[model samples]
Target: MEFQLDKINPTKAIDLYRGMLKPRVIENKMLTLLRQGKISKWFSGIGQEAIAAGVMQNLNNDEYVLPMHRNLGVFTSREIPLYRLFEQWQGKANGFTKGRDRSFHFGTQEYHVVGMISHLGPQLGVADGIALAHKLRNEKKLTAVFTGEGGTSEGDFHEALNVASVWQLPVLFCVENNGYGLSTPTNEQYNCENIADRGVGYGMESHIIDGNNVVEVFTKMKEITESVRENPRPILIEFKTFRRRGHEEASGTKYVPEDLMAYWEKRDPIENYEKALMDADLLTKDDQKKFTDEFNEEIKTHLKKANNAPPIESSIEKELADVYQNFEPKNLPASTETNHIRFVDAISEALKMAMQKNHNLVIMGQDVADYGGVFKITEGFVDEFGKERVRNTPICESAIVSAAMGLSINKMKAVVEMQFGDFVSSGFNPIVNYLAKIHYRWNQNADVVVRMPCGAGVGAGPFHSQTNEAWFTKTPGLKVVYPAFADDAKGLLISAIEDPNPVMFFEHKALYRSQRSDVPTNYYTTELGKANLLKEGSQISLITFGAGVHWALDVLENNPDLSVDLIDLRSLSPLDTEAILSSVRKTGKALILQEDTSFGGVASDISALISKHCFESLDGPVETVTSLPTPVPFAGQLEDQFLAKSRLEKALIDLANY
Candidate 1:
């Protein structure tokens, strides 16, 4: 598996350059169309066409590839239709994304091109997950991820590389280092002379190549890519080139220094490669003219076909149809068959069970495997499932989440663990933009669950302790679930895993080892978009969720005269409007309490919904109580005051009076 650069045929190099030039012509024509207001925006992969096309040429059509926005050159090399590229640019129905995504956002599962994600480095992690799944299933394939030098600045890029390195994943990270991230040069991004040096710190094989040298790129990358597929490992390929176009259609060249622009313009990949082919005697002036003429005609034909295609129907039906494909109720063993266990243990057991059922299930993230998770929830499962299935990922949060999104889209269930809920924010882009929105947008399901340990009061610092339920609850097409008791935890988790849409499963660290409850002794299941009435009373309805439910229960038990109806909002997104209205009708009063901040919180949403639907039934104003608008204090006295918990009996009496 040794690479011989000198052995590359001159004729093949000429052919490769010819292939690269077509995309550049397409980019130039599209830029003209963009200026005419025929296209909304365009991110040209102009000067780096050689690297994009060369690396892509080595990729098999059956293998997966995740591209960034400026990857039309690479995508064209992989046989993506030129007309569809124009249709995408025009935001037409026949576009690559079915008119749902912008020109830069596209996908084709049939060709194993996972997606063209607009969000920076997040897609790299997804590429890693897809590769890991292929390795586990013994599905002989490779995943190639192409990104920009600017993407390396994102935390996700580090996360993805670390996971791929630790797991020996079959993924090739191709960084198209085109001198500048828009107008900012590489010198401003890092102190290192080359972007490839970062790979050394991640324990990955690294290579630096002349991006404009199509021959060298094709020859050098072929063996490295082959080696990765043969024995699943990761490699980082840094292609040093320069961009000849502005960042996007609206951005002008004013910010770019005249000298730098002139220097890169002279070294443009399209023109330089054309000259190289003529020098090598593989192509004559007549041959170049004939090829160029044929390519322009090809582009015109595709554009005509793409523009004539009918638009994709944008409706609510589109959202309903792809939530789950072939969704049948899964056969589960009766609850009586399994022994009684703690909530955290049940969650671990569910992971084990799901992995055994579906070979596509992959568990990854920081300390999830041999360490059994920071809370010891996944104990001993790594030994049973092996390191491949139960993987211990690096401390890269963005990569872990993005990789999970990629795996999910490719029909693998990626159950990733975030060491803490606070770190989940690091992977927010992929979670919200790709994983969550993809289902509703292009009728694609990113079936992934990001397991986060949340809540507070267990002595974790302000950094470690925080709840982000509201953050995800507002996002469309995403499911958010929290468990109260041991049985609910297991049932909810199983349901979350079975769900077609992406879900954020929030597990309270405080509840993991606090106290055990009596779970069901027989078969039981939890439904998505439903709530539970923990207690039934008539005085007032107390709407709460997560750790706040426990706080509500304690107050009700202490006060006999309160007669409060308490509801546990298990699923936050598709709120149980019927149950909410029914309880509010009987009680004629309500109160929404939570441990998170009162401003722009879940409580506010509940109040808004209630005000619209149950305003006529209200005896007085709906009381909403929540934590103070500040960070969770470390001091016990300060925490108690900041927390939304009311003093034992008196608060319940006060609520009943209202």
Candidate 2:
């Protein structure tokens, strides 16, 4: 595209010049502060302001924007006060994250901009989720997201684009190819001549544009945005540009050749745009000087005020207060009529009840649609509720959860089912960083539930079976529930869906069909953070959750002569410490058990907590009975030795003697 100055109105040209200058001046001012050691670090989009101006200028106020670290011009274009930016860098409470997160990592619903987590690929999936939500709700707004050439190397880029294409989502992907990923040249990054070439593989309309020419970007973006608004589709645009400065204010670009730097310097976005506007008489010298002065003065004044802002709080108590969500829920009343159903059937019934109650509820994951999921937990959900709500996602664990995060925040609720509990490792970043902390960081509810089918005992091997509740137990703002009974599975899921928090609901794989009980047919809400006592005794207290609960019950059933109080810990994160301490005090002994490996697992944490709280009540040392630290072996003999009932019985005998 050629530089077409006459195509844009004079008034619009002046606005574009002002928008381009805002980031240029502020970044320049921050560089001086960086050199003085007043600021720690800064990422500048120095020579690529034109692409930002063009892309942002055409966006509808309601559409969502997921910006990269270099897209600070988005904040400027949205009219976010310059003081807030300065306050954020200064770590003040007035910042979007309340001094919690730094740099370009804060967003507000009012601005329709999502604050990005440090990971690049997850946000692309989140953007796709936002676009999906808009489409499902029939909202006219589209979604615009920014990425770099280096980001295209990540798998999430392909995953996000593929899903958006299949769904025909209204998303605009702005890929800014600035020639270098850190110090590595574009030639070393990818084999393709243009980044846009990859878009064809995903079935998207992608194009390469002259990023230095603001008019070109503006015209192309406006046309594409207009068409997307009328008939939604994902579009990928590669803005070929450069960075005059290095990676950051402090990191020198020594790898950049001297000649290449000189070449891009001649085409600086702001400098060239300013001259073009002056030549066309679209912007007067007085207006240009005033705009420059305003940016300069704003930066200097806000920087001083930000420096004088209140210092960060050092209290651990206040910090803890920001960790979990505290909300008043409208609990659904229970029904007395009962029906016999299996554990898997009860979960499906729970989903039906939840979706029927709330129309906005959706279930998303791998093969959950026609395939009915690997466990057949949600086999008929799609036939009941259309495919829009019951989606069969690609084999993208991170994308599924990350997109669910986006969907849940925008007046929609999502239940993401991980195909296997062991696969949660791939999606750990979204679960911990974005989903768990969003509410604590900005007081916004991350209303989503992750249904993790966990535990071993059925010979599903290590990768197919795992009890991952302990891993997420330490994450703040995450609720971990591992239900062992049928009634609790249905009741707790209803409660989890209604509760405005990110909950990791672990359904035991062995219990899905092996356990069947007369669960009530009507909807009910079982309170979270409460323990279930199957049987009461005073000799020794047996504390466990998930498949361990079933094993503990069996141990008690077999040893009728032995006395022990069996406690099923439904919620692992917000542990029922009161019940645990009371039972241990009465019994004067504690035995914690789990199918998890011995090292750094749930059993170890329970042992530590009991030792710290009720040391005087102990007649014998608290023992943690867990499987050996080995991968769940393939051979039946190895698995039998790994999770033998004899081991639990032996530990019981040892505790009884003590």
Candidate 3:
């Protein structure tokens, strides 16, 4: 597309100049503050202002933009208050993150901006989710995301682009090739000629624009954004620019050649745009000076206010309170009428009913739509809910998980399935870093449930079968739920969907088909932080979850004479400490069981809690029965030894006798 100045009105052209000038003014002042040790740090977008200012100016106020650390103009162009930005940098409580995070790392729904994580690439996947939401709602809006040329190397970047193109999602992938990734030059970062060229591989239109030329960037972005709003497909635009300053003030531009710095200095975005505006008679030299002075004064005023703002108080209660949403446990009446069903079928029924009730609920995973997933949990779902609601994704766990976070941002609930639980390691960053931290970092609700089909019984080898719930149970702002019975699976899944925070719902593959219960047919929800006392006895409290519940039950059934208080811990993160303590207090002897290995497992934590709280009441040590510390084997004989089911039976009898 050609740069046409005739297409832009005088007001928009002047606004564009102001947009570029404001961030430059802010950056200069911020640099001064950094030198004076007033602010801790800064990522200067001094020469790269036009890319954010020009592109963001073309976007509607309602459209979402995921900006990187350097895109300070994205905030300034959105007209986010200068005081708030200053407060954020100064680590004041009045900022968007309330001093929880620094700089552009925090996102605010008020400004329709999704802040980038330090990892840099996950936000692209998040953009896919926001765009997916827009397409589902038939909204004439698109999400724009930014990254540096170095970010293009991440798997999330490829996964997001491939999936967006395959789904025809309306996303604008903006890559600001600022000639360096920190100190690493463009030549060292990528082998490709241009970042835009890779867009062709993903079957998307690509463009390269002069990022320093604000007029060109503005006119071109207006055309591209309009086209995307109407067509609703992903487009990649490479904004060719240079970093005139160091990546951050502490890291000087010593690596950049003097000639290279001089070359980009001559093409400075603010200076070039100012001259262009003056040439078009849209801005006078007097107007330029007045605008700079006005911005300078405005920034100084805000900086003074930010400096005076109160620092975040160090309160343990307040710090703990911000981790998760204050979700009151709902106690719905248990259904009198019930249907006997397998655990897998119960899960399918719960999802089907939830989809029927909530139109915005979506399910995404590999082969989940038509193949019903590897386990057939989502069988016939695509036919019932249609492809839009029951979507199938490529084998990109990272992208799908981050996309779910994106969906949550738009008030849409998402369920992401990992074909096997062990694969969650592939998508771990987005879940632990982004999804689990989003609520605490910003007040964004991550209404997403990641279904992990886990456990070892079918000889599916180590990759396919493994118990990994311990990975997320330690992460704050995430709910870890593992259900053993059919009815609990149905009710707990319903509750997980309704939750406003991120939930990791683990469905033990071993129990999916083996377990059968009279599950309620109607819509219902079970409280999250509550445990069920299956059998109350005075001898020993068998605390277990998932497959261990069935294993313990089998042991109890075989030895009817043995008295045991069976406690099924439904949720792990919000562990039902009250129930565990009550049962252990009554029994005097406690035995914790889990499918995960003994070291660093949920059982270890529970044992510690029992020892600390139940020291006076306990008659013996709190012993734990767990799988051996090794990967699950494929052979049945070796697998059984690894699972230690027989050990659990013996441990129960010995603990009960003690």
TM-score top scorer: 3
| lDDT value for model 3 | 0.90
> Could you list the CA RMSD of all candidates, in the order they appear?
3.1, 1.6, 1.5
lDDT (C-alpha) at residue 639 in model 2: 81
Candidates arranged by lDDT, highest first = 3, 2, 1
Clashing pairs in 3: none
Query: How many clashing pairs does model 3 include?
Result: 0
- Give all TM-scores, in the order shown: 0.92, 0.97, 0.98
Name the regions of candidate 1 deviating beyond 4 angstroms.
1-6, 9-11, 255-260, 279-281, 310-313, 316-340, 520-524, 647-651
TM-score rank, highest first? 3, 2, 1
List ranges where model 3 is wrong by over 4 Å.
Answer: 1-4
- What tens digits encode model 2's per-residue C-alpha lDDT throughout 516-581? 988989989888899988789989999988778878777778889889989999988778999999
Tell me the tens digit of each residue's lDDT in model 1 across 1-658.
1223345686666668777878877877888888888767787777877787788878888888888877776677777777776777666766655566686676777667766566677788888878877877787688899888998887778878888888788889999898778878788987897889988898988999888777778878888887777777899989888777788857767877889889888877767767766666767889888888888899889888977877656667764655434355565544555555777776776677677776778888788888898988788887888887787776777777777777776678878899999998877888887787776455667778889898778778687878889999888778899877777777777777877778899888888877466665444457766889999998898888878888888877767677778999888876787888899999998888878887999889889889999889998788888888899888888878778884424555676775
TM-score of 2: 0.97
Better of 1 and 3 by TM-score: 3
Clash count, one per candidate: 3, 0, 0
Predicted model with the maximum lDDT? 3
